[model samples]
Target: MGTGKRRPLGDRYQLISPTGRDGPGIIWRAHDLRLRRDVAIKEIQPLFRADGADLDGARRRAMREARSAARLSHPAVVAVHDLLEEGGRLWIVMELLEALTLKETVAHLGHLPVHWTAWIGFQLLGGLRHAHGAGVLHRDINPGNILLTGDRVVLADFGIAALNGDPSASTTVPLHCAPAYVAPERLRGLTASPAADLWSFGASLYFAVEGRPPYPGSDSLAVLGEAVNRDPDPPVKAGPLRRVLEGLLRRDPSDRITADHAARLLSAILRMEGVAVDPPRLPAARLPPDSFAR
Candidate 1:
């Protein structure tokens, strides 16, 4: 169970090969011996240093990710099957999705069709709505975290997600977030909010239709500066999705469109149906009590 050692989990989940790595975790494609299926296992450790604080932080983040994602029961959200701790390392077992990330998809097929982008946006917004209602804020919602499974879109990687009313939700950890997708308010040292996720959603959709991030630069600092100081160049290929993107990307959180409003607009565009337009009211359901407080 130590580093560089390959060990089965409870006589099942034989590790096959390394699939990818995220922040402080290594993802492995494994065979679930009991279920006779393939699963993705994420191994998290403080590989850089043996400092007690760093390892403790990594453990907390892994637990937070599992708890946050476990409460969300939506088809568009990746399922978390199990969490394990062995030899001071944490492992998370998830459904192995046979798909490509939105980032990979855009790289393969530049500038997705307008209707198709709207449909993808609609699905993502649905998942976001559900998460928000459940009081979970998916702080990181970029293209790389969105997966395309066949025709369905699923949001993956809740590593930095936060629950409402948690003190840690407001603490800024720059390394855990993507520079270009970070909200203007977040750049200004504000707390992470649902609006921040909306901004990221807008940026993601912009990348889908434009084949590039809204804020492009040579380095992380440059990208962050652009995100905080300038408006994204108008998207030429967004077509019907233009307005939705605009509303979500508003610099001021108060001015940005609510999740319900964005969903309504995207839904209309997706179905090719028409609806009268007006400002949307807050959803009736209040944010749920913290479900991750175990």
Candidate 2:
């Protein structure tokens, strides 16, 4: 497709521009012609040369993503509008938001203030709580998948979320996970639970205030080894969040803090510091690398 040309999808959506890549697919900022509104579309490409199993697995994974996300309704959770299989491609239509990803925010500001981090963490916990309540596990949680729009903190990208008790969720093998933020138990090939998500959240929070990931390494394997075999370095800047981080980052899943308790701890920090529940918002234009590609 040329830059001047808009690609139409079944007369319902018109692709404006490709935001970026998402694994084996492309993320597009599209216009819903029928609804006359902007929306984000994840286009999953077909594996042309792969065997039947691989091709079917890809479609199944996409279906799982749509089903997992469609199960929940939360302010902090991004909404999935529809799932379509058009022209041999899987398209996931989602509510589009103008925002900066937590990764971009962190990179732009180096690190966030303790109170702001607390506020974001609190909202994330709320989203996780809702997902868990619905028997969904966000198997992947990291800064890139988090969106900061206005004063609201949104958790996006349920592409790899696991629906509890769904046999298909346990059968598919994950090709990759953000090792720096993945839970230790997950690194050990254990079944993921809400604790795993919390651990990843803790690592993301650690990154928010520290301007770096808790576990350091050059490659994914090295990082996974560090996560599995040792403890993350103590946070020098977490300050009020130190205990919360420690609680969530415990190596043993049984020892990790529950989402509710973590929410309480984060709320306490915000309250003690006299920070407003919804702090001032930053315009997405101010943050560089403005890509809603996750």
Candidate 3:
């Protein structure tokens, strides 16, 4: 990322450097003048060359990302601080998370060990559980959106997140999310639920162990078709995680394993192999009775 000048937003956030892009915006590491801290600011640039309708949709999605993420508070989820509209663009203020995305980590390392992948999955499932309880469906769960920060795994980018029963969210786009990670039911135009997210998680876990998506293809259309019409290839390196992966990637959501069940299996994996790093803060395989009961 290149920097030209120190741009100020709302007279509080001082943009210092570019981080990366997420959803429809460019993320910058900015300084909070009032709080004396660094923060991540997502700048949704206006589509100057596009018509009014296209620009409006982008703005709506960007705003939704802020609002949806703001509703959740969890260790494994990114924190949204505020949202502002300035100079004809939307800026989302968020906690400055200094971490590498799971995608980047996997690309550099080829594949992660089974216990390590289980640790990552365990944290993400907790985050997804919390989001679902809040009626916010991530709709997008892939390696690119999973962040690894030391002992924590944070789920980021709620740009296309849909509140349960909110039809408008589903209407934002004809299709959403990375093709290989999309749930089979989503490809068939079915309503997305927590189960859909689990399917995507399963795909991500498969990638972590197999070094490729189960339904790999050269294009989106072909991959989406395979997801909906066929079963994923059997795992060759999942080892102890084979059962859990199969449970999650089942095409029928009804047959999909519940978060609690998945958590139990993940915890078992950690217990059997033992984690090499500090354990996650939260207790493994346990959720509040009122929040997530499968």
Candidate 4:
């Protein structure tokens, strides 16, 4: 999705700066003309034009991002202020976050303090809890998807899968997740579960501490097989964290840590970091076939 026209996107938004490139989309800082507040807009890339063969299918996938985003209304997830389709392109207007992504933090600071990692883990679990409540599965959960602004933490991308944006039927396999974060079932063309999100979350935590993925290799299949059939190298032996990671990376989805269990386990870490966590919000709709509790 290009700027479309030469004019700066309507008078309603003034482009302040370009953040960076994201696999999910490209984000820009702009001022919301109506609200007079800074906001971010993540518009689909020009991939649609490049892969022009599947124009029809790509259109629906773009629509799915907006739909899934609209289903969620929480502080932790980036708020979807508006979704627009014009000039044969789709754009998502989201809450402009002032903080850096976990990816950037790790890149610049190397490994973070254990407390910080634990705190981030708590926020991610809480966010996932809320997402599950909403009947949404964030098949993609990694360091890049989590953001921290000042003291506030939010999970940026919640729901995504082949059903939503993939040109194919397997949305669980996001290009952004790489091989290190995918669950075992996902690789087999299976739908996503909250437990799968937990598994990815655990892998992200490993990245934070170890600076390496649980399954590090060039081949996607090789990494996934190790992720499913083998155990991850232990974290830096940081007490409950080590145990927490072990449980999170469990090969069996049922054996993995539950979101509730994760929240409870991380409560201490949250308090120790002087972080006051708000309860997660659930989607208004009732349960689905893949209900977390069910």
Q: 48-155, model 1: which lDDT tens digit per residue? A: 555444778778889998999898888778999989888788889999988889989999998788887887888777778788888888888899899999767899
lDDT (C-alpha) at residue 145 in model 2: 88
Model 1 poorest ten-residue lDDT run = 275-284
**Candidate 3's TM-score:** 0.89
Which pairs of residues clash in candidate 3, taking residues 3 or more apart in a chain or in different chains? none
The lowest-lDDT stretch of 10 consecutive residues in candidate 2 is: 285-294
Provide the overall lDDT of each model, using Cα atoms, as 2-decimal numbers.
0.82, 0.80, 0.82, 0.70
Q: Model 1 Cα RMSD, Å?
A: 4.5
Off by over 4 Å in 1: 1-5, 47-53, 273-286, 289-294
Candidate 2, after superposition: displacement of residue 44 in Å?
A: 1.7
Q: List the residue pairs that clash in candidate 4.
A: 134-283, 161-171, 162-170, 162-171
Model number with the top lDDT: 3
The window of 10 residues in a row where model 4 has the poorest summed lDDT is 158-167
Q: In model 3, what is the error at residue 258, expressed in angstroms?
A: 0.7
lDDT of 1 at 95: 91
Candidate 3 regions with alpha-carbon error over 4 angstroms? 1-7, 46-53, 171-176, 276-294
Greater lDDT among 1 and 2 belongs to 1
